[model samples]
Structure formats: C-alpha cells, structure tokens
Target: MTENSNMQSDLQKDKKFQRDPHFISWQWPIVVLAAGCLLYYLIHISDHSLPKEVTIHEAIENTNLFSSERSRNTLRKLTKLGPRLAGSIQNEVHAPALIEHEVQEAQSNAHSSQSILLQRQKGSGAYFLGFKLGFTNIYDNIQNVLALLEGSDGNHSILINCHYDTVAASEGASDDGITCAVMLELLRVLSMQTLRLKHNVIFLFNGAEETPLQGAHMFLKHEWAKKARIHVTVGAAGSADVNFSSADACDRFVRRFHGRLVAACRLSVTVSN
Candidate 1:
C-alpha cells in the first residue's frame, strides 16, 4: 500500500507540471524587453542633456544669472505642484492657486518700483479652441496668466510667452516648470531695471500647451496679439539654436539691442521689420 501511494504521488506531481505553463521561460522575454527599454531611455536622456558647448553667457540668457537664488526657489515652488495637466486635479485646483500666489508676490515686487510701469492679471480664464490630444480623447482648457511690463512707447509690444503645463506622466521640472521660474526671475530683473524699455513686454504663462498648443492658439485671439510687433516664446526642452524666420527682423532686433547680442538657448523670437 505504501509503495502504491508513493507511485500515485509521483504521477500527481508529473501531471501538475504538465498542466502548469512555463512561467520561468515567459519571464525571460519580459526581462529582455525591460532591459531594452532601460537601454533606450538612457541613450535618449544622454542625447537630450544640456549641451556641453553652451557658454556662461548663453546659460545666463536662459537662466538670468540663475536669478540670484530666486531661480531655484521659484522652480521648487512650481515642481511642488507636480504634473499640471489640463483638467487634472492639480491643474484645476492646486496649480492655479500656487501660480496666483506667486504672481501676486511678483506683482508686489513689480509695484515696489516707481521707475517701471507694470500691469498684471492674476488669472485670466481664456478658453482655447478645443482639440483632441494625440491618440487620447482629451480636450484642452485654456488658463493663461498674464502680466505686462508696459513700456513708455505702447505702439510696439513684444509678447513673451511660455507654457506652464506638463505632460500627463512627467514632473515637468524641465519641460516648462523651468520656463515659468525663469519668467518670474525675468520679471523680477526687469522690474529692477532703471533704464526705460522701448517697447511693451507682455509676460504670458499659458496652459494646455502639452495638448495641441491650445493656449498659444487662443493667445492669438487676444487684442494684445494684434498689436505685438515682436513675439518671443520660451519653450524648447534641450535646444540652443535661436531660429529666426526672417533675417531682416533679426537684424532690426539686434540693432534695437544696441549691438548687444544676448545669446538665447532654445528661444524663438519673431519681430516685424
């Protein structure tokens, strides 16, 4: 009876093995795919890292002397909001609150100086024309934060815009969180400048940019856009080239700078010549 039981047990074990799929074998393919994905990610990140050839001056143009410690502070504040996707909870509630606070603080600073004329709208609820994002059935909502450093000459206004929204999965520390922080720093610096500006500079922090550039499209509908002689947009993940569509416009802008060429990384500016 003992021997018969032992043989029966062996037979049951063999049947179990036959019924089970090769789970260990299946794991090997998954492991290979994971490894391939990791390798690809590393390669891509290395390629898009900040360019080594970029100079201090070029970096300054992007960072504005790192805004003397305020750069990191503003960046930290924005990153604390985490991924700000349009219609997400962060986008709907937290991001706007934080941005409103920051803008109020910056505006207070802007108001401190009697030398410059400044006007700001803390939260402008502008609706962008809705469109589906990529393969997803998501529609964009426009939420733009605008401030104008109104120059003495209002005949020609320059619009400087940047998107503050991040993609669905990213922390957006680099994507546009940095841009927002830089804009704050720029606002701070420009406010402190004693020299009078030649043209009005509109500071626009746009939303819904991660989805189909809805914020930008809607920006064109603004009355200020019609009066803008120059439009400067600050958003390029890791590019350094300053692309000018028209050489004549570039020349005129350079001349306006009084022969000072400020190297801008990933900055595109359009000016009517």
Candidate 2:
C-alpha cells in the first residue's frame, strides 16, 4: 500500500511539471529567428544583385577608353604573328611592319588629330662566346613607335612605354600586347576629345625589351628624352595584374585620385635568403 502511494505521488509530480507555465517552449522562438535570418539574407542578396546606373559622360568614357571589344580585336591582330621572340625574324621584321600598318590605319582616320611617327634605333647585337663555340654576333634592330599629342603647354610630356617584343615562343598577348593596344586606344580617345589637354602625351612602343631592355636604353639617347620633362611612364612586365609601384612618388601619385571606384594598396616586401 505504501509503494502504491509513492507511485501516485510521483505521477502527480510529473503531471504538475508538465502543466507548469514557467517551463519555456523554444519552438516558436527558433522559428521566428530562422525566418528573420532568411529574410535578411534574401534582402542582402537582392540589394547586391541589382544593376548600377551610370551618367552619360561615364558611358561615353567607357565606350571610348578601354573598350574590351577594341582591345580584343587588337590582341587578335597581334597574336596572328605568333611567337615574336627577340632577335627572331618575327620580332625584327613582321612586328615592325604590323605596327607600321596599324599606325598608318590610325593616321588615315579623318577624326583623330594626333601625329604618328616610327623611330628606329640600332640594337646592340647579341654575342655568345665559350670554349665549345667561337664568338658569334647576331644583329637585331630596335624600332620605337611614337604617337604625339601636343598640348598647349608643350614643356611637360607623359611617356607611355610598352614593349612589342616577346620572349622565345610567346604570343605575348598579355606579356605586352595589351599594353600596346591600350596605348593605341588611349591615343585614339584623347584625339577625339574636344577639350585641349595641358600636357603632351607620347606613346613609346619599345622593341627588343626581352634582350636586356636595349630599346629603353636606346630611347634615353634621343633628343626628345633630353628636352621633355617626362611626367609619367606606364610599362608592363608581361602580366595582366595591374600594379603601380613607385618607390618615393607613390604617395604623390595616390593623391591625384579622388574616387572609390577602385582600391589601391601600397605594399612593402622583404626577402631573406
């Protein structure tokens, strides 16, 4: 009888606990939190997926400068002359002829006001000497393509430099072709602008860059390099990753930009051997 009484007491305790209002139910709270999070995520994704609007001027600038279609077309033309290695027949002859043809095409356009000129510099011939082989000399000529946009203030000039020559067996589409195409497009765009610029812009396409930067060394010997105050020089080191690295002038260069359209970071690297 006592055992039966104890069982009845335990049963009553269980029933009381089950009916207590203090015992919190988590089901509704969890559902609400989950729903809130899902709604927030949907809203965030929709906000980011929407298209951005641009001004008319920005649209014009986009079409005129750095047009992907135009650049790609130029790249195609460049790659047609495959493997423009330094001192090779393709680099020495075909590349120069192609550049000249493009220049002539640009000149023939009735809309542009820039002057296109081709300057040829004699390259330092290659030589190899060893015990197994005697000294051998190979002659390779350097050609520099220049497009001049003379500004009202002729004292200052900006040099845009890119090499047309490539390493052995490289089509150089990214190595330097892109840079040359960009320079050409920039010249075309600048020529179309009605407003006169303050400083002259010179486009310099150097040859034989793969062979000890001989083209640049030769350019320094020109009369234009002597008189002109070279404001900026944009060159490529055979890649699409656009990184501007100026030792002391980076801060000054950064000060010229005023928008958040692109992020720029200054990095210092240290190496140990």
Candidate 1 residue-wise lDDT, 1-273, digit = tens: 999999999999888878445356778889999999999998788666744443435534653233435666677777777778877788666766666676666556553432333333222333434355524333434566677776767788888888778887776876777777777777766764555477778888777787656667667667777879777776654545543333574677655554344443333321110
lDDT of 1 at 216: 72
lDDT of 2: 0.64
RMSD of 1: 13.2
| Model 1 regions more than 4 Å off | 1-66, 111-141, 238-273
Model 2: weakest 10-residue lDDT segment is 264-273
Worst 10 residues of 1 by lDDT: 264-273
User: Residue-wise lDDT of candidate 2 within 177-224, one digit each (tens)?
Assistant: 877776776666666565547877777777767765667766777766
Task: Judging by TM-score against the true structure, name the best candidate.
Answer: 2
Clashing pairs in 2: none
Clash numbers, per candidate: 0, 0
TM for candidate 1 is: 0.57
